[model samples]
Target: MSATGNRAAREFRAEIREWLRAGLTGEYAALRGRGGPGREHEAYPERLAWERHMAAAGWTCIGWPEEYGGRGATLEQQVAFHEEYALADAPARVNHIGEQLLGPTLIAFGTPEQHERFLPPIVAVEELWCQGYSEPDAGSDLSGVRTRAALDGGEWVVNGQKVWTSLAHEADWCFVVARTEPGSVRHAGLSYLLVPMHQPGVEVRPIVQLTGTSEFNEVFFDGARTAAGHVVGAPGDGWRIAMATLGFERGVSTLGQQVGFRRELDALMALARSNGAIGDPLIRDRLVRAWIGLEAMRATALRTMDGVAAGAPGPEASIGKIFWATWHRALGELAMDVRGAASTLTGPGHDLDDWQRLYLFSRSDTIYAGSNEIQRNIIAERVLGLPREPRP
Candidate 1:
């Protein structure tokens, strides 16, 4: 970077750092280090308020263009923002699905009317959103979604169930991928529709997790209705748009996520030392390997951002997914080992400690955003020029 660029980057970093220091106070001070991964049930109302506070101050959706209620922050500045937020231990964001995934997807594929209607709320944190892609039968095979939606006069009537939908219970809307054509199958007939969550036809049932929290949910859309104009991109073009949303999912937010990962590893190291787990050569070796893995993840994420900066991330995004998911699951296992006997116990109410919560929550990391098997196939076929897997 040029001297001028370095100066600007430093200024941006300092700006966010100072803002975080000033903002995370009073009621918000207690929100720091709350609400992440398995612990999404913690003080959600407060976190939502904090996010709206951020949006009011022009802090949300910084990567978006200035015309769309964002700061038009460059890739570097956005990275600085997330890094500073995580470093400050600010509350895990409540509107990530809207801000990171759907906002960019709308900017890319939405009509002007849709953009006018949706983007502002996302930027203002007025509405929370959830993704409705996975079904009980589909999980990693998103192409196999059974959720079906058909035009009914001026609206689309949807009927199907979505499983493992994160924050569905709290969302005001959902970006759903459903089959629109009657005879179409697999990737062909899908359409991405933005459906409201507060309707009578939409039922969100929280799926209790091992951590004793219910961030993930089972959402049933029986006769759920969305406006005819709510479909992003053409009716049959949802496969592409959905893939693009997944690409955005692996974008700069992963940098902030890595900061949290580093904090976890650091805390685990301290525990190992205090509890004498560090005396075990195997434990010490795993800790060192975790650190090395985290460094590599960060480097790979920075490299991947170039693709994201240009447009939607390509198949190379799968490499980062596979790397981080495996590393985090392993970190969870290592956390359990670090805690030794205490790992097996819980509080009187069966409440989990941070390490226990980490262990339980990280178990799903590899499975949620495309499984290890699915990511490997993507890397092999798309990134490595391997032949497509034979389909039955």
Candidate 2:
């Protein structure tokens, strides 16, 4: 908040803006406005190429310590970078899971050997990561993870299924949460294992979504294996480490996501005007509310970022997950209503246009990462100091 910091932030923002303006042209120009939530399938090879380009330019993992091949950007600087990236319409990043979530977790809890082995590949974009937390039976309640892993020889053999894994098929590694203790239940006796995705025991089946894209997948681990040392933190500490990672999941990148949301809302408002929806009092009111909600979300995200900047996010971070997820879902509804009847029909092959895809994909916005119901529970129990919900 000092004058020096303010000047630095402004300079950083300008530098990022200039870089994006210059770099987004040439081969990457066509990639602008592609590879977001519902559109992860768009220009994937090109996006990977863009990822390597960013790594080379020192733009990837900007929040990580400079010793780890990152910029060691301050929280404000990180926010500025993301906001500028979103404004530039840079392709949605391919390394978000690795860079944002796993990277920080490793920095905090990983051993020196683990850091030396894992951190470089992530910074270099040599290895992609997918989270293995949600299972068919345990979506929001992470403690209910039934996937089991056992040490066999020098490796841990993992066996279970992880559902709704984002980009698992494209990932080289998966950070898996599996039960390591025999007769373990709920949050106990679990281990957070970093498992390789290319081995014979693992299988990835893409789950086609309503938008006709498969950004998420069902990963089956008949006997997936990771080195005994691949476990982050200690055995039975998975719950704590996993909770920290979830906190990271809702960190500064969300500010960037809000920038994207603002752009989407602006487009939706423009659509409403062009389609005469803005002439209607109801549609116009919704658009105004959407804009106001976006501003509020931005403010709240900044307040929350203070905690994220200090260290791994705590329970209060749930506030952000609940707020943004609900807001985005509502925006999707607004997009559909703006489109009116056209939202009902697709061009061909059930192909969805942008608005339609927005509506459909946004439905899961509340569901994934963490569900609204789950988020409310976290806020009530963790943040508000309320009584825990009674389980059946």
Candidate 3:
């Protein structure tokens, strides 16, 4: 907050932009769609190449400590880096789960051995990982997950299916939650384990999305084996571990989306003004509301990062998820109106090509990680101290 700090942060941003412009080349730009030369891509190698480029710069894990292949950036530095990268139209980083969830949880809870094994490559983009928490019947109620993991001669044998797993088809590993003990109360018998996806009995089946592109998968395990060393916490202790990861997912990961989405929102506003939608009172009011919501969400995310940096989880993290999801949805709506009939789905080169895809994707914002409905329940019961609903 100091003037000196502001100057330093600004200088850091300038340095990053200069570096990105120089090294963010035509081929990489074409692959990841930085400028007009690159706009459309659906290749894994391209994303990997771009991730490697950023990781080598110590810019991949911007918030991570210097010891773990990161730059030991401050919270402001991380946010600024995200925004600046996004505004530059840099290619998307592939190891989002690593940088956002797994790395943070490992930092918080992993043993020195675990940290030494997992942290460096993740920051260096050497390995890809995915979440394996949700099951067929336990999408929203994470406590209800029934994937079973039984200890067999010191190794855990896991058997179950995880639906809606993002990037598991290509992920080298997954952080799975399974019922280590059956017949125990919900949330009590579960444990978190990191599974190598390439091993036996782990199958990743991609599920096609509304965009005609598959970004998630259905992972089935029939006696998948994981070492005892892979366990995150004690058996029958996954609830708290998963909650910690979710808190980070909602707090940290959501902030990344907010930073990126705010740029899109700004572009949307700019387009709206150019299209004369700014003259309409209703459209203007909605845009004003969106801008306000974005500012509030960013502030809340800042507080959450501060909490994480300070070794304390902020209570406002839950509410911030709901706010940003809703904020993005609103922007999507405004984007459609601004685009007019162009919102009608069309192939690339269409006036609203990006907007249409984003609009559909925004619908899932409230559903993934944790649904907004679940978030509201947490707010009502935990934050508001409301009486719990009576059980059947």
Candidate 4:
């Protein structure tokens, strides 16, 4: 370590790394660790067990408040925990969206009653939550969501469909946005609602992916009624609340994937060196570029996380997301180049299909949480002080 290196950071890493090396050693080798997001059965007992163990140890959410199922660790410590988990190859926490997005959002904008009811379960991984932001015509443009919720019999009757709801079919509940007033502006009419999954009027159908797996689903609400108490924040306030959650989606809480990219880059280097693919300058050059991309992503993500913790809302978060998404595509291309035909071949367990599936999944990252093109627009107009482009 350098003389100027932060001692607190080093100490935190040491403590977490020791526990991880001991806890993640054997019998759980099937654990993907920081291998990035993968398809797993919803309500998988084993995955839930691992998450419970982490929560019990106060590691599941390092930065969450102590009263709300967290360690109340420093932001620096939180980053250290994420890095250590990735380095130790521990399985990713099962209910990341609940912990990452919903938890933070509720902490910021939820009422005391709502927090007391939902926060604990979210930390315990007992209640899985899916986002219901994107509607049929609203993927990247979240403000265009047209799902309607009306007041009826002292309850909110939601009648609309949500597409691209990740794992909603398996979730115990969902945090959804619905339009409450027809004449209000796009962002002003929205309200956030929490609806249970086992209701009579709700329908969920899985959408299978190219990897021959089903994870995300389409959710339909046919006069699905929810109590007034389930409403988050206030009517016409969901836009601001959703933006809070989206900040987390693009901030420190979502940096796990970037860490996983490090392990992948390492694995690629080993594969190239050991398999004699390094003999060709073409292969070597691609490997170098891939490694550089991973490093760039880590640096940018870490910096943006620090800014987020400091309460500075910076546009740089989009940089990491965009860069990492592109890196995934580039690595997939390189992986295919290295393995020639095996890269395209989908085989059983632990094959190149993992990379291929990740590649396909990365194709969605740019489109979700606002598309990369939209992010570029924001950077040009909002960040770089450029003139706004007129919308026809």
Candidate 5:
């Protein structure tokens, strides 16, 4: 970047830093460190209010185009925004699915009508969104989805079950990938439908995770209805649109995620020192490796964001997913080791400490989004141009 760009970025950084420092006071002050993966239950109502407060101030969806209720922030500005937000320890966002995933997908693939209806609510945080891609029979193999949706009158009637749906109970809408053609299989005959979540045909059952939290859920959609025009792309083109959404999923917010990782590593190192775990050379070595891994993850993320800036990410996004998921899961293991025997115990009423929650929740990092196995397959087949895996 030129000196002019540097100066602008510094100014942008300072603006957000001052805003966060000033806004995170009174009621918002307690929300600074609340609400994230496995801990979405933390002060959620307040967090929702806080996000709206941000939306009202034009802080949400800064990476989108100005016409789409965003600031039309450049990639550099977006990175600076996320980095400063993390550094401020602001509450984890409540509308990540809508802002980061669906909004971009809509901007790239949605029609004008779709845009006019959806983008404003997302920008305003008026509606929360969730993803409905995984099914009981098809987790990471997205093409194997068995959910079915068919046109009925002027609406699409959806029927299926979606498992491991994050924040489903809280979401007012869901972007679902379902089979639209009767005989279609694999990646064909699918359509991406945006369905409402509060209808009588929709039921959200919370799934208890290792952290004993209900952030993940199983959603049953029976005769759930959406407008005929709610499809993101043309029918039978959902595979492409869904993949694009995944690309957006792996985009800029990851820089903020890395910031949180750095914080976790720092706190764990401090705990190790206090608990004498640092005396163990093996533990010390793991801590050092964790720090090194975080640096590598950040570098890879910045490089990948270039592709995102150009357009939707390609198969190369899988590389960063595999790296961060594996690194975070390992960090969890190291957290347990750092805690020693205390890792096994729980407080009265089975309460878990922050370290324990980290260990348990990080276990799913490799599984959700896309599993390690799925990510490697994507890398081998798509990124590295390896031969396709033999199918039965």
Candidate 6:
């Protein structure tokens, strides 16, 4: 790093650390270590208030430009912000889709008017957002999306279903991928449309999980309407725009996620020690391996951030996805085994305890956000220059 860049990073780290140290007190003290992954249902109202408080303090969307109501922090500084937030055990952000994915996509592709209309609310945490890309059949094969939209009377009418949509019930708007051309197939004829979530003809049903929480949802859009201008980029450009948004998903915020992983691994280690599981050589080996794997994950994530800092990340982001997902799934299993026979029992209503919830949710990590099979295909074809997978 340049001397100036180094100084800026140090200052940024110190600023965030000091801010979190002071801010996480009194009303916010109870929120420590709550609201993440399987536990997102925790502290709904308090978390929202905390996010708005963050917005008021200019702590939201620090990577966005100043004109867009963001601090436009440098990449190193963005990393610092996430690191500090995780180290402080801040609440899992409820607006990640809006801030990390959609906001950047809009800045890169949305028209000037779209920016003026959408960016401010995101900055202020006034409107939450959810991703509309995944569907029952199109989850991994995004090009197969069957959600159809037709323009009529200056409005785009949408009809289709999206499944595994995180935070859909809470989102005010969804960036949807729908077919705009009737006969077009694969990557063609698709439009990325911004649709309102609370309007008529839109339905969101929470998908209850083994954890007894409904973080994922099934959303049906029946003749939902949005302004004709709500499309990002031109018609038939959804594929490119959507790919860019996926690239943004593997950005600096991933470092924050890794911090959470480190915490989970540490907690598991503590549990093993307290319960005398550490006396078993096999369990001891697994704990050491988990720690080493986490360290490797952090290093790899940092290297990936360098690519993201230069431009839109390439298919190589799949490497991080595969590594972290596998590592976390193994960690969850380790959590169960470390608990011995006690892991099978739950308190009342068959409700999942913390370890049980982690195990169940981690099973989906390799499936969602592009499945492991699809990620491998992307890496093989795009990164290794291998032959494309044949289509029937």
Please give each candidate's TM-score: 0.99, 0.98, 0.90, 0.91, 0.99, 0.98
Q: How much lDDT does each candidate structure score?
A: 0.93, 0.92, 0.78, 0.77, 0.95, 0.93
How many clashing pairs does model 4 include?
1
Answer with 3 or 6, whichever has the higher lDDT.
Answer: 6
- In model 4, which runs have C-alpha deviations exceeding 4 angstroms? 1-5, 25-29, 32-36, 253-255, 311-313, 348-352
- Model 4 Cα lDDT, one tens digit per residue, 1-392: 35444677788889999877776656554564432344555235666777777777766767788887787877777778777777676775668789888988888788899899999988877799899999888777787888899888779999999988877876999998999988776678899999888898899998877555666789999989888878888888889888777778776644556677776777777877887888889999988888777777777777786666764346666676677767786776676677666666766674436668766666676776678887887778867889987764
Clashing pairs in 2: none
For residues 1-392, what per-residue lDDT tens digits would candidate 1 score against the true structure?
68887788889999999999999999899998999899888999999999999998889999999888889888888899999999999999999999999999999889999989999999989999999999999989899988999999999999999999999989999999999998898899999999999988999899988888899999999898999999999998999999999999999989999999999999999999999999999999999999999999999999899888997789999999999999999999999999898899998888788888889899999999899999999999999999999988
- Residue-level lDDT of model 2, residues 17-93, one tens digit each, is 99999999999999999898989999999999998998999888999998887898998898899999999999999
Which candidate would rank higher by lDDT, 2 or 6?
6
* Residues 1-392, model 6: lDDT tens digits: 89999999999999989988888899999999889888889998899999999999989999998989899799999999998999999888898999999999999999999999999999999999999999998999999999999999899999999999999999999999999999999999999999999899999999998788999999999989999999999988899999999999999998989998988888898999999999999999999999999999988888887778875677889899989999999999999999999999998888788899999899989988889999999999999999999998
What are the runs in model 3 whose C-alpha is more than 4 Å off?
Answer: 1-4, 31-41, 251-256, 274-276, 348-352
Candidate 3 pairs with clashing backbones: 33-38
lDDT accuracy of residue 150 in candidate 3: 88
Better of 1 and 3 by TM-score: 1
Those runs of model 1 whose alpha carbons end farther than 4 Å from true positions after fitting are: none
Q: For model 2, state the Cα shift of residue 59 in Å.
A: 0.8
264: Cα error in model 3, Å: 2.2
- The full ranking of all candidates by lDDT, starting with the best, is 5, 1, 6, 2, 3, 4
